[model samples]
Target: MFRHVKSNLLLFLLFFSGRIVHAQSRAVSLAEALQFAQQNQLTVHNKQYNVQVNEARLRQEKAARYPEISGAFDMRYNQQLPTVILPGEFRNLPAQNIPVVFGTKYAATAALEGNYAVFDPERKYNTGKAKLQENISRNELLVAQTDLALEVRKAYYACLLNHKKIKLTLGNLGRSETFLRNTQTLFQNGQVQPVDVDRAQFDVQSQQAELQKATLNLNQNLLSLKYQMGFPLDSAIVLTDTLLLSGERQAVFLPDELKVEARPEYRNLQLQQEQENLLLTRNRHNALPTLRLYGYYGSQAFREKFNFTNTTEKWYPVSYFGAELNWLLFQGFLRRAQVQESKIALKIRHNELLIFERDYVFQTYSKLLAMQTEQQNVHVREANVQLAEKILNVTRIRFENSLVQSQEVTDAANDLLEAQTSYLNALYDFILARLEYERIQGK
Candidate 1:
């Protein structure tokens, strides 16, 4: 008995602490949560990083157009002097062979060399491709943001709907408890059978069970909302938004005004198509001849015994500038294969763009229809809830006047709860559908 009492006390303390935490929860609106998610969500941050990386790549490509200058130095010693054979007739010694080295035993040289592309057909296209890639990355970041906003909306709506359900459940629970007390009073006055009192008690227990279930569901939905918002789940939060529809009807867009091109995803695909076309052009231009201007200014020293510091030693300076042209007449058909591959890829991307446009048109129309249907369902459910309330009030009055059975009263209460739950579900669906429609419109 003592152990049971101690466990009950512990449960009471936990329940009381939970209630206090709930009371102190910070209130947040849907817009505030979405803004917070945009600032702190890991996915959005990663997408932003990708955009930065592509921007840097664009700078690198542009910088490549400048001339390149480099300095080089080298020192070398000949282990065995290089020898060249000369005819013996030069020395007037017939039938004799003599070997002579043409270069110094030790040598050192330093030079600064510069190169500039005089004519490069592919460079212009490469810069263009880099700029296009940066634009694509920016659009991709926008796409990620849109996706994250949709996820936040879904989770937020679910949490708000769960909160509304909990409120309605609590109201029903209160009414059930009151009904149970009235039934017990009638039994004490010998006005109703013991079975009727037992039935009333069971109805109250059922309502308690429902309240417990709704509370658990609400807690889980809150955790989901927190995860979507990138917020800490251990912290307490209260949603300030209510699950209800505004009296005004939402504006619906016609098919012609859908403007699929406004969507980031579609724009990204178009950019990709441009990239593929650019690749094909670049590959085709690869066969063109490239001309480059190169120049070097330097000095060299040649010593018989590595005596470069000797006053007698001298340094020879050299300078020259020249233009070189290189034409890759053939690369074993490698360029041919690249050109063919690029053509195929460009075609593939074009096909994807067409398919995407068609699918987006269908999807947007479908969502619009769903939003309209759900809006009508919300109105219908709202009316049913009102009717259920009236029916419940009448049933209770009938029970008090001894004109109806206890089971009828319980059934009426159940009907009202179901009607209220259905209404909340309808409202949630309508809101989600509307959000999706807006998303498809690129809002």
Candidate 2:
């Protein structure tokens, strides 16, 4: 009896654990979807790394302005002492040629060195250029983030639209089945012809086919949404948000003025211009001379038998400080060509900025017009759907009262479905246009 109880307990625990795992895949709202994509998208990660790389480069350039300090230890063993010819008077010998060896078999030296730039125009310009490049990288990261958010929102809305389509199709299929059943009952009572029954059957089959197609399309859109959100494709996800036409219609409006400078692309272009100016400055400064200050302090030891470690052995101290001036008298006009190139680049960027500003204004105006048109379309489609629904209801009543044929009722049902589909499509377009307009405004 104890073994039987243990087995049941184990089975219960296994079932409970599976439920917990399944529960982890909960429904996601639009806000949660956007947040998840921001955290998980690979493109955002790569852009973030690019910003870090630029920061590191800026630090490297700044370090060059400060004094550089280094230390070293070097040792040498003389296999053969250097030989030198000695004068006869110095050696107290005859004037005949004589060669003698110099002193130590082992030598060692330790030194500390330091260098500081006193004046360098090119280095100063390069530091400024590095700072501008870092700003450019930051703006590029912002661009990537904005683009990803827009893509996620678009995909999310598409999924919502497809979900709505499937619901409408399923509802129509249910109504079609009811109509077929009513037609069959009338035919059995000898009130309707056999062809009428066949027509109702055909209507039901068409609706069923449409429902199947809609279901397939919905699944495809859900997969696309998952891909945009960086969610695992095999995982189950339920979208908790509903697309309402009323909320979107309230957001349509035209701004009095567009802030072109607020966009990251515009800022990036401005940064490029600044960088080119700095480059031009650096090239012109390259012609000027550079001045640097350097100093070193060290101790040298020499021993005949590696006895420098002995207390009695003496060491020599060497110290010096000096300044250097390096002037490039000529370099085959390379500096001149570089300066010209930078000048041309700066001019090109200036023109690009103007072109972009003008184009941005035009696009904003065009999108505003499109939003107005879509807003009108939504109203028209909404009224048409209501009208179609009323017509379908009247046709059903007439069929029951023997005032119309079953084919007329089927035609009315198809018209209602068409109207609803058109309405959903209009809503989809309006929502996307609003999203794009908001993005352009940098909201």
Candidate 3:
């Protein structure tokens, strides 16, 4: 009996542990969602890596200005040593010439060498260009993050809107069910015809279908929101935010002078233009002379046998230091072509920057106007929903008293649903427009 109890206890513990392994539903606010997206989004990570790459490039460019040093070791074995012809007078044999070997059969050399650019016009410009490229990459990352924040806000609002819609549809369904129940009671009392009962039942079924659709839409929106937040798709999530219709209204004032510099794209383009200018300078300087300081120290040994361990064996040392000046007199017109290309690129970027500035101002103005219009529409739709709700209640009461037809009650219900839907749409649109306006203004 003890053994049986032990087995049962083990089974119970396993079952409990399995349940504990399942993750609980997470409740997230809009701010928390945006934070998660910023930290985990793939695009943000990619942009961050791009910034890192440019940083590394900048470091490389800076390092290039420093001296370089290297070491080398070499060994050679000659089966047949090289020989040179010697005149006979050297050997006291007049009018005669003989060939004699001069070098040992084995030779080895060790060397330490270094080179430094003492004067290079292009290095300075190139380093500056690398720094500008790094800045451009950083700005691009900022642009990505800003765009993601706006997307998260929009998706969060969409989910809220859909959730409210589901609630509205469920309320409508409840009302239809109640109306159906009341109509059946009236028919039983001989106060209403069977056709009235049938109509009420039809309304209930239609409302049920509508509720189902609304629920599906809410779920879809929730999934999309999770995707944007980089949250687990299979995990349950509870949005801890409530839609406050009255609190959504805020005063917005457009700036008299738009600051294009506040926008990352504008800064990125500006940096790109600067980079192009530096490239042009570098290309123009490429035709100039380059001066470098170089030196090497080496030791060589030659032996007829493998006797490197012999302390008495002498190794010859050679060293030299000198400055070299290199002037690229010609390169098939490559430097000139590069300079012209860079000049053209700079001109193109300058024009593009101008166009972007104008377009940014225009777009900001347009978004502000649209946001105001949507805000106004939200108010109008709110009023319409209130009126529709009142009409629905009146119609339902009149139908109960046999003063209105079943069709009239159905029409009122439909109008109320439509009004609610319109209000939700207007609210979402206003939120979207406001978010866009803030983004455009670089707020």
**lDDT on C-alpha atoms for all candidate structures:** 0.83, 0.83, 0.84
The number of residue pairs in model 3 that clash at the backbone is 0
Model 1 worst lDDT window (10 residues):
1-10
Error of 1 at 183 (Å): 1.4
- Whichever of 1 and 3 has more TM-score, that candidate is 3
Write model 3 residue lDDT over 1-443, tens digit each, in one string. 34335434643563475355334678789989999999989999999999999999999999999999999999999899888999999989989989998898889899999999998997898789789888888998999999999988888888888778867776776677777878888999999888898887777767666766776787788788888888889986778888654556655545546888888888888888888888888898898899999999999999999887687999999899999999989999999899899999999999989999999999998988898899889889989998998898889889989998988987888899889989998998888888888887776
Better of 1 and 2 by TM-score: 2
Residue 369 accuracy (lDDT) in model 1: 88
Pairwise TM-score winner, candidates 2 and 3 = 2
Stretches of model 2 off by over 4 angstroms after superposition: 1-24, 85-98
Q: Write the per-residue lDDT of candidate 1 for residues 286-378, one digit (tens) a residue.
A: 899999999999989988897877868888898999999999898999989999999999899989999988988898989988988988888
Specify the highest-lDDT model's number.
3
In each prediction, how many residue pairs overlap at the backbone (N, C-alpha, C within less than 3 A)? 0, 0, 0
Cα RMSD, model 1: 3.9
How far off is model 3, as Cα RMSD?
A: 8.0
**Which candidate number maximizes TM-score?**
2
Model 2 C-alpha lDDT per residue in residues 1-443, reported as the tens digit of each score = 34335434543564475477458766899999999988988888888998899899899999999999999888889999899998777767777667889968899888999999999997798789888878988998899888988988888888888877867766676676677777778888998999988887777677766766776787788788889888888987878888865656765476647899878889988998888888888999899999999999999999878776787888889889999999999999999999999999999999999998998898788878878888889899989988997898789779977999877887898899889989998988888887877777776
